[model samples]
Target: QWNILSDYFLCFLPEKQPVQIRENKRYESIKIVLSSSLSKVKFNFVLYLCENIFDRFLTFFQREEPLIHLLYHELNDLYRNVLLSFLKSDSVQQKSGQDLLNINFEQSALWISDKEIKIGRFDCERTRKLMSSLNFDEKKSFYQDVRKIYITIANYLKKNLLLNNMLLRDLQVLDHSSRTDQSSGDRIIRIARTIPNLLDDREIDKLENEWALYLVELVDRSWYIKDEYIDSNGNIQITHVASFLPAASQLRALRSMHRSCA
Candidate 1:
């Protein structure tokens, strides 16, 4: 690139301009050529050069906020990933600097992983397959690593967690607000009516079923509930069980799990 630019300069530079004479005359050079309108030319050239450099730099450095946001959104769809790959590669590129580089492949390899797929809904066989991908590393003391690809799938999953949690939370509130003896089976049926708005019917059914089981497990395990149930109007009423660990806590646990064995 330098050679090309130097050649262009040599060809276009006026002969009346001063020539540089070096100790190695065979390898002589000219100083940057100037014009009476040099400043204007230089200003324009600098602008052009800055833009050229910026174009190159942009793929390296993040610039304007809106542009970056748009780029990320567009890139996400184009790459159909969380843009973790871009982050990882940018990280690597920053560390490797100017001129020639010589590094061993094994040493250069980025060893961290980033992939997130729900372990919750997966069946026994599919879940087993996911476990197989983890390979049970002893060094990290974590049985599985969540990120396997260059891009960590955090951005994608974060939105999903928000969406799913919102939908489920709304359903829980609506169900609890109603004062009636809803049959155990029919409670799921109420959820069935609204599945399309929340998730695909099949997925919503699966998620709701698991959520019910989770609630049951929580009620069963609670010392407050097991020890404190009272007979109200000849009915054993177990009320006000403790909530599950907050989603933030769960996400943090998963993130810790991802980084631990890595």
Candidate 2:
């Protein structure tokens, strides 16, 4: 049985071709052509692999570490290449082009020293100083590159379904605690009330009504807010007022109430 299985597997293997070569010159010619072709293919494959190895590194880190230090070298190379390409392709005057080309391309090495990583020194103070040292056009070009990086990160998050995960976690965590929900609702209501220009009276009223309904529902369910009472049948009942209105009906009511108050 084992021999039969081995024979079946060997049948699926690719058949090797036998090479036919002459004794002297033809043999040398075949060897040279084969070696050169294989070397070229291997070099190209390795280069491509190295270029894309760090493409997904950002998604793995998830903003927990210092993004600037992690991206500094890669971003420097990217910005330098982009700047050079732009200068080469644009129809600028020769003198201005030369000036742009002459601009010193320096990478930020502030966060690293002697092959060791330095922590706590990569703050906004050092960053502001670095930006202030740049010339006007250089500053503009750097900011353009920064914007492109931001867009790239945002697109990556969207592509990998990370944005939805983050948003869902934020919503669930915020709504997990009754105190958190109440405090957040109160803050929103206060902001709406204090800043009439920010939120009109109608909007304020609508927000307050929605918040009130949410609070009522939360209070009805949360044992911390509402006490439990034993009824005649010995079943436990929450002592808070239950929301009479369904969610959709409550929102509609709130909207109408806001319009009336306005």
Candidate 3:
């Protein structure tokens, strides 16, 4: 019964599945071209982290802002920092000159646990021997190549994965910080322009007027509601909830109207 349901539900799956499978095969083929097993492992691990870092960041949803723009910056920072830290690490001190690259891949292998779906067990002894056999020039060249790959991957992520869409950028106006900022008028206009049916010219003018009034009220109330006080230990603490955007309720009403029409 499950198989029958899957067959019916996924009838058009063939249109997309083969292309993905072919892409995966091409990626695997490229990995096969890399001569060193350690290099292959490093490449695979970096790619795995690149693909999964967003999922890791999603776990912080309860603590972090729900804005996509914020997520893009935070996730990009986390990914780049991890890769940069790995590239810059030179903890194996005893080795002199380019022999820094001669260390065992075991250090790299230790990064992942056996529970993680990684490549099979690394032969640390054989890897160490292979690395140590390389001369200074060879080691230098290999290190440069690895560094280039990491940089290229980082650039690829910035271009493809991060949210650079105009609509997403305009949506930032809904965030608490942007909502309360004096300079968010343009962003608010952009949001209204993007979702025209949701906000006509008359409503946009109304919102602008409301926003001005809202900011005035917020300033007046800040002294009472948004307050900072010194504790007994002399540590300053802020205790205030940010005000919601006035445009939010309007958008919610628009959504309700669309749903009712549907």
Top-TM-score candidate index: 3
Segments in model 3 whose C-alpha atoms lie over 4 Å from true places: 1-65, 69-72, 75-142, 161-164, 219-243, 247-262
63-167 per-residue lDDT for model 2 (tens digits): 442222123233333333333322332322232222333433232321122112111123223334444555677555544554344335334433443222222
Candidate 1 yields a Cα-based lDDT of 0.33
Task: Name the best candidate (by lDDT).
Answer: 3
- How much is the lDDT of residue 163 in candidate 1? 28
For model 1, what is the error of residue 38's alpha carbon versus the real structure, in angstroms, after optimal superposition? 7.3
lDDT of 1 by residue, 1-262 (tens): 4345455445433343335333433334333432222322223333432343234444543432112112222222322222322234433342211110121212324333323322212222333343343333421222133233212333333334222232233233222222133443354445445433433556545645654554445333452232444576776666532222212322232233224423
Clashing pairs in 3: none
Pitting candidate 1 against candidate 2, the one with the higher lDDT is: 2
Q: Return the TM-score for each candidate structure.
A: 0.17, 0.21, 0.45
Per-residue lDDT over 71-141 for candidate 3, one digit per residue giving the tens place of the 0 to 100 score: 53454455444343334334433332223323333345423322222222252333344546556776556
Task: Report how far off residue 149 is in candidate 3 (Å).
Answer: 2.4
* Backbone N/Cα/C clashes per model: 7, 0, 0
Global local distance difference test of model 3: 0.48
Deviation from truth (RMSD, Å), model 2:
19.5
- Mark the regions of model 1 whose C-alpha exceeds 4 Å error after superposition: 1-28, 32-43, 49-262
